[model samples]
Target: MIEPTAEPAVEARGLTKRFGSKLAVGGLDLRIEKGTVFGFIGPNGAGKSTTIRMLMGLLPMNGGDATVMGIDVRQRPEAVRRCVGYVPEQHLIYRWMRVKEVLWFCRQLHEAWNESLARELCQQFELSGQTKVRHLSKGMLAKLALIIALAPEPELLILDEPMAGLDPIIREEFLETVLQSFCRGGRTIFFSTHMLGDIQRLADSVGIIHDGRLLVHGSVADLLSRTKRVRLALERDELPAELPQGVIRTWRNRRECVLTITDCDSQKVQHLEDAAQVRVVEVLDVGLEDIFKDYIKGQREAI
Candidate 1:
């Protein structure tokens, strides 16, 4: 038996995948610590699903290696699968099956199925155990998928856009449930989503990817401190012709300009205001969405 403390919940080294002429995932290396929520932020068609599929052994890797729970995902995929709970971006259950049937099938396949856990999730999510998969609403279906993923009680959970089209209340409930599950320790979650608000509220660390490349990965506080959003109240109508080195994005309005600095110190921010001959009316903290935008813009400029 592999020792429990030997490896991270998920680790990928030089992971690459390609589709025809386009490279979907490019030589990516990832490490997800146990008991942490790692958010994957990227635009549509940025190879987020492709990477997750390869890790789950649903798709073959063109290059590199990945492991889940100390088992090689490519060589011993079944063992890796047994340790992972996955909620895909799209529904993957059989429409003809009833809720109970689906859960029973999962119970047969996974050694870690917890019947009590499934029942509790179903009750909390307000799902009908007897309802057929085809008859459930979109939110109910999403809830079912979550329950299935949690029922197994796997060591790691990989969710792709788990909050796609649900009501705000349901989304909050789902996030709370995930947090509750993680409280026990030694369980990790890797979630990919466009919902920046939920990411901000829940993520322990974030990884930003753009055009098949990772731009930045760090704690939320580290990212916020490294990036700045400054609103300058200027006497003049236009920004300075020469700007600082770390300014990533800038937008100008009448007698005012909002500047985004990617790598900024307090002195640099002060210098920018002074150089523009403006008074800093407000220097608000940057949110996850702003950081994501700056990261994408930086990536585009690099290409």
Candidate 2:
């Protein structure tokens, strides 16, 4: 059972990271509830990886504090590591170690290691004990990282670009495993990815970071319900080319006009239709990708 109002499994209060003259992450605050799939979306070099590293205590934060599983990550990095599992964007396992040896080594270090769970995971992922880590394909390597991280059953799992460099079939399998096995037991997942569709499908909440700052963070339903794409099928071509106020994006397709309206009520769409007097065919759902593009475009225009 999830503990509502429980202390966050992972908490960041005004976290900031800098590199000389550049600010990598600027005053970010985040709270990851227990037993949730929280997705982080941002382009490469947008500070997602930097933020993760800081949270993991691989890098020190310039300001603010981070706690993982109620332990201060900066002050007690090793203690936090004991309760947290991290899979980096790049594979970092020993290439010469066979799969069985690596698992055995992990079991030795992690106090919470469950041998039965490890063996079951190896079977589920189709990883052979005799296979050397160097001989495993990229997909297999990714799965192996996941297994190692999860065998100890850490309270918080941090995955950076976990789906990167994976084939389609492997990606699906990986996601299914995460949703079915990992989340089933009420573990919290902090996953970063550029795959908007997966985020939409898997995340209970999402945080969108852009250019070293957080743009928005909320539940998926709140974003979709708050942002909508208003599409109208015109009876004539006399409609105004200019979009209504609050419309972030507009597209015209010969007798039809599509407008992406932000933070508006459903009644607002009816008002727009009445003002235009156009036959409204349908109001299409706005996707996260389109919303992200429009947000970036608007930011560019503002500058």
Candidate 3:
């Protein structure tokens, strides 16, 4: 288990936001420790972006509070911005300016901008300083946005779907760059995305949100360990009218039944077998993607 430290890099308590009668985010409580790569995942319009914007002080909350790098977002938003780097889904840079000019302009805005780091990143990304932003490809544009965020050298980096539209190769490169360059010296990352592969690869911890509510938050290993797929072969070619406890979802045909379950253990499995009156054929590990799908599906069914 990953132990949390006393002080968290980011913390939110009862964070709430609303658009007219629509509640975008509701009572979201979260904590991300320093140096941890935390993935915030949800489907589209699941309040992932709304929560992030509130945390970044770019959006006003209807209720509750948040702190980024130990600075209160409501009271000291500018201070929080200074201590955190943010990369929104859209790259809103000046397309008319050259890459070097863009860097220069942004440098003047930030007190702790690292020119050396920015130059190094430009070289690594093969971004020519003289090239205009409009001339850069989608991949290059994405790299530039990342470069701008990292060059600030903030304690916390908040990314809102940073890899949303990139091709497979560029996405791989982006993840690798983040892993190698930014995940050092105890810098924290709060990454928001619907990509299960990215979360599995990059995040130490994960939080899943659905309909403005956080469904689960924990270490990746712990979640995977506790969630499993149990295959059962029944003597009778029929399933029980009611599912066993802890089973989130189930699929069956004839004598075969596959169960998706949570909080799984030897005792739980034994109970399930006894309760369902079925013979256990195999207990299989569940992947992050399947787990995510099950969670979302379960929530949708409940609604």
Of the candidates shown, which would achieve the greatest TM-score relative to the real structure? 3
Residue 281 displacement in candidate 2 (angstroms):
12
TM-score of candidate 1 on Cα atoms, chains taken together: 0.86
Residue runs of model 3 more than 4 Å from their true location after superposition: 1-3, 233-245, 252-257, 276-281
- Could you report the Cα RMSD, in angstroms, for every candidate shown? 3.9, 3.6, 2.2
The lDDT-based order of candidates, best leading, equals 3, 2, 1
What is the C-alpha lDDT profile of model 2 across 39-142, one tens digit per residue?
A: 99887898999999999988989999998889998899888878888889987998999999998888889899878987887898889999999999999999
Error of 3 at 255 (Å): 5.7
Tell me the lDDT of model 2 at 203: 88
TM-score of each prediction = 0.86, 0.85, 0.92
Model 1 weakest lDDT span, ten residues long: 1-10
User: 35-71, model 1: which lDDT tens digit per residue?
Assistant: 7789998999888889889999889999999988778
Pick out the ten consecutive residues of candidate 3 with the lowest summed lDDT: 272-281
- Evaluate all candidate structures by whole-model CA lDDT and list the values in order: 0.83, 0.84, 0.87
Clashing pairs in 3: none
Q: What lDDT is reached at residue 175 by model 3?
A: 89
**Local error of candidate 3 at residue 260 (angstroms):** 1.7
Backbone Cα, N, C clashes tallied per candidate: 0, 0, 0
Off by over 4 Å in 1: 1-6, 230-247, 250-259, 270-284, 301-303
